[model samples]
Target: MKFRVKKATKNRTCIVSAAPYHPYQRCKAQGHVEFFSDFNKDSLFGVITFYQHKYENKVIVDGIFTTDIGIDGIKTSDGRPRYTAELYNEDEEMIFDLTSAVFNNAIQLVSIKKELINLEICGDEGIIGKAVVLKRGGEEIARAEVYRLDPIV
Candidate 1:
C-alpha cells in the first residue's frame, strides 16, 4: 500500500509494471519493487538481483538494484565457494539459486547483475509490480531516482 526508499550513491532508474488483477474478483492486489546496482569484478561482488514472489495475502513485489537485495538467503554450507541464492515465501518457502533453481525454465543467465533485473510473475488473484528497490551497502536508499519505460513497444 505505502513504500518509502532512502538514498544511495550510484543512482538507478526503474519502472513498475501495472499490477495484475484477479481473474475472478477483479480486485486490485498489493505489490511493489526496488532495484539497485554494483560494480564488482568477481561478478559476484558486482552482481544483479531479480526477485519476485507471492507473499502472504497474495501480494507480489518486484525490483532490481546494485545493493544486497534483502531476502532470507543461504549458501552452500561446505568449504566450497558459495554461490548466491534467495529464499522467498509462497504456499511455502522456496529457494532460488542463481545458477540452478528452476529445472523447467527455458532460459537462464550465467551471471547475475545487481543493476539489471527482470521479474517473471504469474497467477490468478495475484499482485505484481516493477518498481523494484535498489540497494547500496545493504540499506534501501530513499534518494534513488526512478523513471518509466515507454509504454508502446
Candidate 2:
C-alpha cells in the first residue's frame, strides 16, 4: 500500500504567512524616521510629554516672574507703594479671584492636575454635540465633537 500527501484546499484548509521576522525588515516597514539638522542643540528645553488619565488632566507652565518696582522717589519708608501690578484670571467664574498675594509674591502661575470626564451628547436628526474647554480667561483651549455608535451585537 502507498500513502500520498494532500494539498490544502480553499474550503477545507488555508495557509498563513508569519509576520515580518527580521528586525531590519520590521524596522523598515514600521520605523519612525526623525530628521535632524547640524544646527540642532542638545541644550534645548526639549519636547515634554504630558499624559492625561481618562478622568484627569494636567497643565504645565514655566518661566513666570513678578517684579516690584518703586517709582517717582517712592521709598520703602513710604506708606503706600508707588506701583502695584497684578495678574488675574480673565474669567472670574471658573476660578477664585486670585492675586499676587495668593501666589506668595511670585508671578501668578497655576499648574492644575484634576480629574475630568469625556462626555458625549446626541440630538435629533443625528446632530451631535461638542465638548469645549472654557478657560478662566474666556478662551476655548480645546474642543471635540461627539461620536455615536451602536452597542455591540
Per-residue CA lDDT of model 2 for 100-150, tens digit only, reads 222212222343432222211222311122221212134332222222333
The lDDT per prediction is: 0.28, 0.23
Clashes of each: 33, 2
Off by over 4 Å in 1: 1-81, 90-92, 95-120, 125-152
TM-scores for the candidates: 0.22, 0.18
* Colliding residue pairs in candidate 2: 55-116, 91-136
Query: Which residue window of length 10 is worst by lDDT in model 2?
Result: 25-34
Residue ranges of candidate 2 with Cα displaced over 4 Å: 1-131
> Model 2 lDDT vs. the true structure?
0.23
On TM-score, the candidate that comes out on top is 1
Candidate 1 residue 12 Cα shift, in angstroms, is 62
